[model samples]
Every structure is written in C-alpha cells, then in structure tokens.
Target chain A: MKPVTEAELHTYIDGALSEGARAEVEAWLVAHPEDAERLRAYAEQNALLRSLYNPVLDEPVPAALLAVRSHAWRRYFAAAAIFALGIGLGWLVRGMFITPQMLPASLPRLAATAHAVYSPEVRHPVEVTANEEEHLVGWLSKRLGTTLKAPKLAPLGYELVGGRLLSGPQGPVAQFMYQDARGQRLTLYVSRQRGEPRDTAFRFSQEDRVSVFYWVDGNFGYALSGEIKREQLLNVAGVVYKQLNP
Target chain B: MDRRLIIEHIPRLRRYARALVGDRYVADDLVQDTLERAWNKFYLWRPGSDLRAWLFTIMHNVFVNQARRRRYEIEQAMEEVPAVSVRATQSEQLELQDVDRVLRSLSPEQREVVLLVAVEQLTYEEVSGALDIPIGTVMSRLSRARERMRQLLGGQTVMPLKVVK
Candidate 1:
C-alpha cells in the first residue's frame, strides 16, 4: 500500500531490485499509472544513452589505428634500438656504465656481418692491418676482457689469413679471417665479452645474402659467418666453440 | 606484447580519456604518457590478460597520480575548464537535446557512474572495479544518478516495474 520511493523506482526500472521488492514495485505501478510515465522518462534517457555511444563500436577502425603484425615487431625492434642507443650514448658521454653487455644485442650482429665482408683480402682486407696480429689480439683482449684466439678453420678448409681489432660495445673486438686455397673466406667473429649467451645455440641468420652464425657462452661470444649450409654453419660454430671454449 | 599493439588502442583510449578528463590536449597527453609508461613496464604484463583494460587501468592511475601532484593547478583552473559536449544525433525527441546538458550537470562522481553504466554499458560490478568503489556504493551511486537524471528530464521515466518469473 506504500508508494515506491524515487530511489527504489530507479533501481526497480534498472532491474536491480530484489525479487520481492520487484514484485512489490510492479503491484504498486499497476495501481499508479502516473508513476509509469516517470519510468518512461528514465527509460528514454537510458535508451538515448545507449544509442549515443553504441555507434562507437560500429565505427570502422581506421587502418592506421590497427596494431599490425609488422608494427608490433617494429616496436620490439625500436625498444631494442632505443636501449642500444641509450647505452651507447651513455658510455660515450659519461663513460661510467653498469656492464659492457648492456650494449644492444643487434649491434654485434651488424659487427659480425661487417667482419664477414671485410675479413677476406688477398688485396684489401683489414683496416688496422693483420701484420700486428698479436697487437690486434692483445688490444682487443684488454678491451673485451678474455684471452683471444683467432680460431683455426682447416677442418672447414680455410687458412688463418689473420685478424683485425675493431670497436664494439665492449670496446675492441677481434675479426679473425681464414681463406681456402681457391680463395673462399670465413671470418671468426670474436668478442671477449660478446654477451650472455642468446638462446645458447648456433643461430644462423641472414641479412641481405650474407649468412652469420652467432653464439655466446659465459665468457665470450663468437660469430662465424659466410655463404654456408645450415649444417656447415653449425659445423663452423662447433669448431669456433671448440677453439674458443677449449 | 608490442608497443604497436598498445598504440592501436591509443585513439579509443584517447576518446575515453577525453570524455573522462574533459580536455582534448590533456586527454591526448594522458594517452601518450600511458603508451610510454605501458611500453616501459610491458615486461610485467601477463600474456592472457585484457590489454585494453590493462591500458585503461594504467591511464586511469596515471591521471589520478598526475591530478594528485598538480592538485593546486587543477583547483586554480578547475572553474575555467570548459564543459564537455556529448555528440549525439539530433532527433525530434525532447530528451535528446537536454540529455547532454543534464548528464553534464550531474556531479562528477555521479556522472562517472551514469556514463560508465548507461553509456559504456558496463555492469555494476565492473563499474565498481573501474571506479574503485564498493558494489553497494556503485548501485547507490547509479540509482542516485538515474534519479537525478529523471528529475532533470521533466520527471518522465519509462523503465518497467515488471517482475520476471
């Protein structure tokens, strides 16, 4: 027999009232058609609210708005690139940093490919020249922080033409070269403190037409790259790991 | 997983942020900062969770934190901030024209509950979590907001008081 309060009426309209409360409101509304008009206004507002915002879902998502697969990968790369640049710039400016490996992972791969391209020369091979192999090895050793050996490649059919000291995130890296009798060449890309092992196996990656086999262990990292088969590449990795780790 | 995936949600997040913050530039900045912070802290993101909600939660928190730090700035400019205009198609209905004004007239707390419940169509529980309020409080706020809207809209109401068997 009691009239429904405004609060109860609102809840009752929204279907939030308890079952008993709902039934009570229903019985009261039947006796009071005037209250029905009040309910209609709230319902109209709710309807209009839904109508106003619901179209947002139906709006066509602009192509530019999509998080494309490539975009995700680019973000991944950009993060890496920024991290690398930050570390590099920090080292360049302050010279005080946490660890050498804080240098970006991608930079070594670039260095490795560059090593592969320039290591072989009957004519013009190394920039610093290989006649000072010991100086090259010694200088890079002090910078990279482990003993350096230009790994031999006779089993893979190449001769140690020698090596060059190059700058890396860790400071200086050694690029050791070996050439076959027919003039085919392979480079043993060694960094004293290359990095913590990435996935801990020989990963053969190609940038352009050049193939690179890069691996890392507790002490150092090595990349032996050339135009080679997967098995041949892994075989190169095996030889480099043996000469470096052994 | 990727910053780009999070970027894809930027415009929607921006729109939502604009609605919530009532400033276009601030909303866009909130979205941009949300994206940047989300990118930095992404390693903490779980694989299976809802990224949109995650982004929204981050944006919501960032807005709250910024508001706290800049409370003086907010208070000084509070009265000067322009009122928001809701975009709705014009119709012959008397309610449509004033609905936007009526909705805006509600207190911010009440307006949030009404918009999230009625416009966003979120469940009471979800709105409670999103707004960080108790479910009971959510219901009360929602009921209060609806009642206020009803009063403003010429006291006309249409939702049924029917019992479901």
Candidate 2:
C-alpha cells in the first residue's frame, strides 16, 4: 500500500480527494487508530467552524445590499427616458443648425471608432492592464482631473483587460478595455468636456461592427462600445452610470 | 448570464464575507460591493463555470483591497506602533466562545483558508482559484490552519456541565 501523504490528508479533510483515493485513505485510517482520531478532530473543527458561521446564511440580506439591483434598474429607466427625449429633440432640430464651423465627430462615434481600432488587437490592447487597477485608476484620475473608478464588471462576464491614455480633441481620454470569457472585448472611453452640464442622458449609436452607449455626467463623457447587442450594452452602461454617479 | 442567477449567490457571499471580516456591517458592505462589481462585469463570467467561486474571488479581492486601505489608515493614525498579539493558550477548554476567539486569532491568510474550506465548504481547488494561490499553498495553509484549530479545540469535552442540586 502507498503511504498517505500529509497533503493527501488535507485533501481528505477538505473532501477533495478522488473516490478511489478516499477509499484508500479510509482503509489506511481504519488501520491507524491515532491517525483516525486526528481525522475525527479535524472533522470536529470543520463542524465547529460551520456551526459558528453558517447561521449568517439565514440572516436577511440588509437593505443596502438589496438596493444595488433596484437602484440600477431605476437608473436604467431614467436613462432610457432621457435617451428617448434626446432622440425626439435631435429630430426636431435636425436641419436647424448648419454653422460655418464643421462639427467634429460626436464623442460616441469617436469612441466607437476607437473601440473598433483597439478592441480587435490581440497584443497591446491596453496601456496599463487591469492587474494594475489601482495605478490605472490613479493615473487616469489625475490625467483627467476627475476621480475615475474602473467599474467592476465581473458579474457581467467581463474582466478588465487594461486601460490606456489617449489624446482627445478637448483633452486626454481614458479607455478601459474588458474581455469576456469568449474573448469578446469592450472599451469604455471617458473624456473631459467643457460646457454647461447640459446632458445627463444616455444615448446609443452604432458605427460599423461596434455599438456605443454614451452619456455625459458632470464634466466627464463616457462611451461604452462593444460588438454586443444594444439591450445587453444598455444593461452594462446602466451599471457603469450608477457606479460613476454613486 | 442572468442577474438573478448571480443574485442567488448573495447569501453565500454574505456568509463568507461575515466569516472573513468578522463584522456584520462590514460584511454586508463587502457583499454590496461584490454584487455591484459582479453586475457590471457579468459578461466575463463563463457560462458553465462555477458562479459561486467567481463571486468568492471578487469578494476576496475586495476584502484584500479594503484591508490594505485600512492598514494604511491604521499606520497613519499611529505611526511605528507595533501591533499587539493575542494568543490563545491550550489551557482554555474549547467552548463555543473559545472557538470564536481562536478563529479570530488566526492570521488573515490562515483564517481565510480555514473559513473557505470548513465553513463555506469550497473545494481546495476552488479556494485556490478564489485566493489566486497555488493548490499546494492552499493545502499547506489548510494543514497548518487545521492543526492550529485542533490545538485550540482539542482539550474540550462536549459533555454538558453538571448542575449542583
């Protein structure tokens, strides 16, 4: 019979050993009374730990935590309403403004273009990867003169790949990239804008293969672009908006 | 992935966080943060992967980050003050209170491993994934943690205390 290693014993206590290995450990334990006694002690310790903390699972989730989902949906509806109003207003003033100055591409279009250019890159997708999230947030916050937090997107099935600093027409732009399990990537482009805080509305636009959901909050304009459906992108955008606003 | 499916893990997340932080309010805050983060990046989660393990991983990262920030705060408040150590002696019989104290007495790394394995019932591999540690490291830590727990609880007999007539 092979000797039972300490690591194997640990795995046995953890209930992680294979069935055959477990049978071997059980047979070995039956022969070694002292080892069996020690295993019993380990089992008792696990029981104690569970008895001490498992009641927490029965407790009602606090209101604050429950509020996250409700708050997100509320923001989603608000953004949708504002978006509808913006579309209506855009059509009303479609041909009214023809100024001599050529209007630069809208931020959403610029963001989608940027997303198309970078999201497909296999290497060098971001300047600073998500592994250095603290540095990424700090650098971008400093460069943009606003506190920027990279939204946690793990629940939405995207992990931050990295972020980059890009030059915009107005100032520096921060682009955060996230990749899903299937290797699909999304980019969040944030830029500083100087104007009366005119819009807090969320707007959607598509450029080629990428779709963008953009919104202006305070001094920052955020554009989330990906090759994803509008409804799905809207849900992600709603989360980003709530986090940024909160 | 459906948000509802992620929401189903909240109770377990809270349980793990409560054990991890040893504070109810702080645990709830960690859960809230974890949920918000998870909801935002829900796409990154693989369709058939263990959602619970993924949530625990996020909670672990949040807990670590918060601990790092709090350590900074403590340092700033009292510079160069050595932390006081509270050790459990074997003389104390392993009552429930003693178990609580001993669990809290563990170093954070050991405490997390023990809690994830014993309380949360996560497999060693799941713990390794959640903690971003090697499986060997997880096994070694679990071994040490279980030994410490045994020494702490070994002497106690669970027989009821006798009452004088």
Candidate 3:
C-alpha cells in the first residue's frame, strides 16, 4: 500500500477526501497511532477556531456595513475609501447626520425599509406574536438593551400584531407592528442612539410611500412608519409617544 | 445584480473575518470592504460559479491589503501588544482564551488557510480559490499550521465540534 501523506491525514480530518481516499486514510490511521493523534489535535484546533468565532455569525451586522449593498449609498464608498486609507470607518461615521443628500444613509431609511418589508407579510409578520406580549417585549427589550413597551394602539383602532428584533445601524432594534380594522398596518421602529441622550422633537422622513414620524428620546430613536396620511400617522405617533412616555 | 444574494453571504463572511482578524470592529471593517467591492463590480461575478467563494475571494484581497498596512503601522508604533494573552501553565484543557492566544501566535498566512478549512469548512479547492493560493499551498500551510498549533497546545483535551452549537 502507498503511504498516506501528511496532507491526506489533514484532508481526512477535514472530511475533504474522496470516499476511496478517506477509506484508505482511515485504514492508515488504524495502523498508526501517532498520525491519528496528530489528526485529533488538528481537529481540536479547528473546533477551537469555530468555538471562538462562530458567534460572530449570530451578531447583528452593523447597519453601516449592511448599507454597503445599496447602490444609492455611494457615500459609503467614500467611507470605505477612508477606512482603506487607515481611518476607522467608525470614526468617519461618528457624526452621521441625516441630510437630504445623505437621506439614504439615515436611520429612517432603515426603519422605513423594515416597515415595508415586514408590514406586508400576512402569516409571519413577527417573530413573536402579540399573544405572547410579555415574552415578545422581554425578548426585544433584552436584545435592544432597553425597557421596551408595545404602546397601546387599540384606542386608535389598531391592535398590536406583534413585534420583532431587527438589526440596526448601532445594534439590535425592536419593531412593533400594529393593524387597524381596515387591515392597514403601521410599524414603530426603535433603535438605540450612540450620541448624547437628548430628547428631540419628532422629525418626519418619507421614503417612497412610507411616511415615518421619528424622534429621539433619551438613548433611543423611534420612527413610526405607515402608508397612511401624515396627519393620521402623526396622531398615532402622538398617542404612541404619550403611552410610551407615560 | 441582485444585492440580496450578496446580503445572504454576509453572516459567513463576517464569521471568517472575525476569525481572520481578532478584533470584531476590524473584522467587520474587512466584511464591509468585501461587500463594497462585490457590489461595485458585481457584474464580474460569474452567475453559475460559487457566490460565497467569490465574496470570500474579495474578502481575502481586502484582508490582505489591510493587514499589510496594519502590520506597517504596528511596526511603526513599536506596539508588540499581542503578547498580552495570559499563558496557561498547565494545558490540562485548552480554554477559549488559550486557543485564541495560540491562534494569534500563528503566522497570518497559516492562520487564514487553517481557518478557511476548519472554521468556514471550505473545501481545499474552495480555500485555494478564496485565498488565491494554490491547492498544494493550502495543504502545506494547513499541515504546518496544525503542526505548529499542536506544539503550542500539546495535551489539550479533545472537545466536541463546537460548530454543533
């Protein structure tokens, strides 16, 4: 029998060898304890590598990083260029402002996109249903690292459909979806702010047909998005703000 | 080009980057660079070919360039800071910290090769394509990397494949 090379030993551990080759290597390993021991060490090292870094896959990809796929986000290229030039992208985007020119780069866009994508889902709009309100709230609050309340929209003819944890620019965000008798849906998107925790008046940002009434209160940024009239959304937003604050 | 396909690969790319670069921020920066490059020249990607491998190849280029520049900066700063990992006297069982410390001690080339195979579970051909190294180089580097790690972390209790979690 031809000698199984060290490469074959590594390949056998990796499960990359063909069936015949693998069988050949297995036979070789049975005859050779030293090489088998070496293979086990290598396999253990791989396990360690996976254990150390696989958690990253579960982490929310930074909102800035997610925005790179948008062609409208040409500005991100400049940030990437700066990063490539040795400037931390984090620092370059530290003072991010939502100007009309940088509108696509705003948190409101993220909120609006989240609303558009989710509000239309019929059967599976939320990860946690409103039936398990406490569980939903607790799960999202833990993820967003803030005490979250699914505001009472029933008074305004909309019932809490449910809520979900979303990936935001800074970290995990909470989105609470509400539906009225007419089946019109609205989403309140809550994301944490990294800047100084100061309260700001509600700011309106319209993307396509998604009208978002957003505000910054303390460390959290809230955006209420719906396809309804601005006045109606504002009224709901007012009620939401009041219920949330109260 | 549908950018959505690129988005699907982001998690795995981030995983590889996290392993390739120890710092989460730096790892994400590499991922962002890869995303940006893939988005810009998305037309270059052959449709039938492996999108994950293509994205990974782009990540490899971004990582290598950033590492070259970072190595220069570290060299300039005279910051031999990686030595800070507390060495365990007894390798009774290789803890996460000990594993990380040993991995950092590896040469960057070996680290990437081994990680592509072990962590990402890429095939030898896939690893070669992703890292832009030949098949022979991948095996040689994997062999050398595992041998070095064996020497550094001798007698570690074999743990289950953590990927199961």
Ten contiguous residues with the weakest lDDT in model 2 chain A: A95-104
lDDT, candidate 1, A1-246, per-residue tens: 987776677666565779888878878777777776667666677777765545544443332232122323335545565577785674453343332223345644765567656854557676444566677677767766777766767777877776676766666677777678877677777765543443233444565555676655555667777765544555566666666655
Clashes of 2: 16
lDDT of 2 at B70: 79
Candidate order by lDDT, decreasing, is 3, 2, 1
**Model 1 lDDT on a 0 to 1 scale:** 0.61
Comparison by TM-score, 2 against 3, better one:
3
DockQ of each: 0.16, 0.20, 0.36
Binned by DockQ into CAPRI classes (incorrect, acceptable, medium, high), candidate 2 is incorrect
Question: TM-score, chain B only, every model?
Answer: 0.66, 0.78, 0.82
Candidate models: Cα lDDT each = 0.61, 0.74, 0.77
lDDT of 3 at B49: 91
Model 3 chain A worst lDDT run, 10 consecutive residues? A96-105
Of candidates 3 and 1, the better by TM-score: 3
Worst 10 contiguous positions by lDDT, candidate 3 chain B: B156-165
Q: Estimate each model's TM-score.
A: 0.45, 0.52, 0.58
